[model samples]
Target: MIGKWLDIGPTTQIEPGSARTLPVFGGEEIAVFHTVRGEFYALVNKCPHKAGPLSQGIIHGDSVTCPLHNWRISLRTGEALGEDKGCTPTIPLKIDGGRIFLLREAVVA
Candidate 1:
């Protein structure tokens, strides 16, 4: 089924080169980041290494270095930067009229 877009907050809620964590329906958190290059990406906030909150991480280029262990993961593709075969899931995001929207049906693995 298709899900509707959820208004997260104003686009300014997440600045360029910064990230924000939004609460979801099932006790899960979603991390939304806007790269310094002005691209929006979303993914599950939990890191696969030690279950760290990825939203609290720092953005370096197109990758986010996990705050807990410094594990770098790609925000665009949800894949670990290096040395990992597994990856978290990415969510669908849309921006319109300076507001950020997140799709409710975020897929994870």
Candidate 2:
């Protein structure tokens, strides 16, 4: 399904090397990450392995380590890294004039 861009907030709202979880429609949440390299990524907040909170995980490079079971997931592609199986959904994001935007559609697994 086609998704519309929904403004989230200013890019400054999230500090570099940190993440924020925003509650979306259908009671699901999206994890928005600001990398130390000044890049932004969005992914489904829950880990595919054990529904761990990715937002609370440690951010290193472009991947986040799942808080529940140490599952590492890529922020760029939402794919589980190495030796791991399954993946979470990714949310397309955009930045305009220092503001962040997210697709309004529900994330698919």
Residue 69, model 2: lDDT of 95
lDDT tens digits, residue span 6-97, model 1: 77788887789998887777788888999998889999898878878988899998899989989999998888888865587889888889
lDDT of 2: 0.90
Model 1: ten consecutive residues of lowest lDDT = 100-109
lDDT of predicted model 1: 0.84
For 42-80, candidate 2 gives per-residue lDDT tens digits of 998999998999999999999999989999999989999
Itemize residue pairs with steric clashes in candidate 1: none
Best candidate per lDDT, number? 2
Kindly report which residue stretches of model 2 are placed more than 4 angstroms away from their true locations once superposed.
1-3, 106-109
Model 2: how large is the Cα RMSD against the reference? 2.7
